[model samples]
Target: MSRVAPLAPPWSKQDADGINRWGHPDRTYEPLLLVRCLQRHPALTAKLRALGEALYVDATLPPRLRTIAILRICALLECAYEWGGQAAFWGPIAGVSEAECDALVTGADVGWSAEERTLISAVDELEATGSWTEQTWTALGGNLTDEQRMELLIAVGWYRTICTLCNGMDLPVEGWMRPWPG
Candidate 1:
C-alpha cells in the first residue's frame, strides 16, 4: 500500500485547476502520481514539473547516458515507482536494453562498455558515499565533455529529488506499466 494515498476528487478549486494543467484532459491521473500528490501546493508542483521537463529537453547530455544514470539512481534508492516507469517507458527509447535495465537493479555492469561501467560506478559511489571518488571523476573527464559532465551532475541530483518524492509518497505504478522486480 502507498504510504500517502494520492489525492482524490472533489479536489479544491486550486487543486482541480492543477490537475487539469498537469494531468490529462480525460480526468485520469494515470501518470501524474508526483503531480497529483503535490497539487495542493500548486507552485511547488509546477516548479518540479518544469524542472523535470527541462532535464529531458536539455541536449547537453545524451539521452542514453542520462537515462542510464537516472535508472541507476532509481534502482539504488529502491524507488519502484520511478524505476518501473523509466525502465518500461524511457529505457527502450533511449536504447537501454532489458539486460542493462536488469543490471542496474542487480548492480551488475556486464555488457557495458568501459565508459559505461565508469558511469554506473559513479552513480553507485554517489549513492553509497554521497560523493564520487577521484577515480570516477577522472574517468568521467576522459569520456564526457565539460557540458556533459555538468549535465550529469545536475541530472543525478535531479533524479534523486524525484526518487525522494516518488518513494516518499509510495506512488503506485501506472496500470500499463509493470512493477519493478522484487
Candidate 2:
C-alpha cells in the first residue's frame, strides 16, 4: 500500500486546474497516482511542473538521450514507479529497445554506441558519487553541446528527485504501466 493515499478523481476544480496545468498538455489527463499525490501541495506542484517543462520540453538535450539518462537513473535508483512508467511509455517512442532497458537494469553490455555508453556511465557515476569525474565530463563534452551537458545534469537531478518521491511514498505502479522487468 502507498504510504500516502493518492487523491481520487472527480476532483475539485482546484485539483483539476492543478492537474491540467502540470500534466503533459498533449496527453489526456488520467489522474496518475503521482500527480494526485502532488496535488496535496498544489503550489509546489506548479513549481515542479515548470521545471519539468523546462527539462522535458525546452531543454536542448535530445529527447532520446534524455530518455536514456532517465531510464538509467531510474534503474540505478530502483524506483520501480518511474522506471516502469518510462520503460513502458517513453522507451519505445524514444527508440530505447527492451534489451537496452534490461541492460540498464543489469549493467549488461548491450551494444550501445560509444555516446550512449558514456551517457549511461555518467548516470552511474552521478548516482554513486553525486559528481562526475573529469573523464566523464570530458567524454560528455565530446558528445553533447555545453547546453545539452547542462540540461543532462539537471535532468539527472530532476529524475532523482522524482525517484525519491516515488520510492519514499512506496507509490504503486499504475495499472496501465508495466512493472519492473524481470
Candidate 3:
C-alpha cells in the first residue's frame, strides 16, 4: 500500500475537472498515484500539470538527451516508479536502448559518449551539491548550446522533483510497466 493513500469518493468529486485534466488520457489514474494525491488540490494540480507538460511533453531538448537526464535522475534517486514508467515508454522513443536504460541504474558514466557522460555528471553534481561544479560546467559548455544547457538543468530539476514526489508518496508502478533491469 502507498504511504499516503490517494483521495477517494467525495474528495475525488471535489476536483473532477482537475482530475480529468491531469488524469490519464484514458481516464485512468490507477497507475499515477501522484496525480491521485494531487487531484485533491485543483489549483496545485493545474500548476503541476502545466509544469510537467513544459518539461517533458513539450520540451526543447533532444529526445535522447532529455531521456538520459530523466533516467539518470530517476536512477540517482531510486524512484523506481518513475524509472520504470519512463524507461519502458519514453526511453526507446527517445533513442535510449534497453541496455543503456539498464546500465543507468549502475551509474551515469556507463556506456555513454563523452558529451552524454558529462551531462550525467552534471545531474550528479546538481543532486549532490545543488549546482554543477565549474569543471562540469565547462565540459558541458563545449557540447551543449546555451538553450540545451538550460533545458538540461531544467530537466534535471524537474525529474528530481518527480523522484521526490514518487518516493515520498510511494507511488506504485503500473501493472503493465516493469522497472529497469527487472
Q: Please give the CA lDDT of all the candidate structures.
A: 0.79, 0.85, 0.77
List model 2 lDDT by residue over 72-121, tens digit each.
Answer: 99999999898887887778878988888878888888899989988998
Write model 3 residue lDDT over 61-150, tens digit each, in one string: 888988988998999899888888778777777889877887888653356888788777788889899987778888888977878788
Best first by lDDT, ranked: 2, 1, 3
lDDT of 3: 0.77
Off by over 4 Å in 1: 9-29
Model 3 alpha-carbon drift over 4 Å, by segment: 9-16, 23-31, 108-110, 180-182
Best by TM-score: 2
User: Which candidate achieves the best lDDT against the true structure?
Assistant: 2
Clashing pairs in 2: none
Q: Cα deviation in Å at residue 147, candidate 2? A: 1.1
Worst 10-residue lDDT window for candidate 2 reads 22-31
What is the lDDT for 89 in model 2? 76
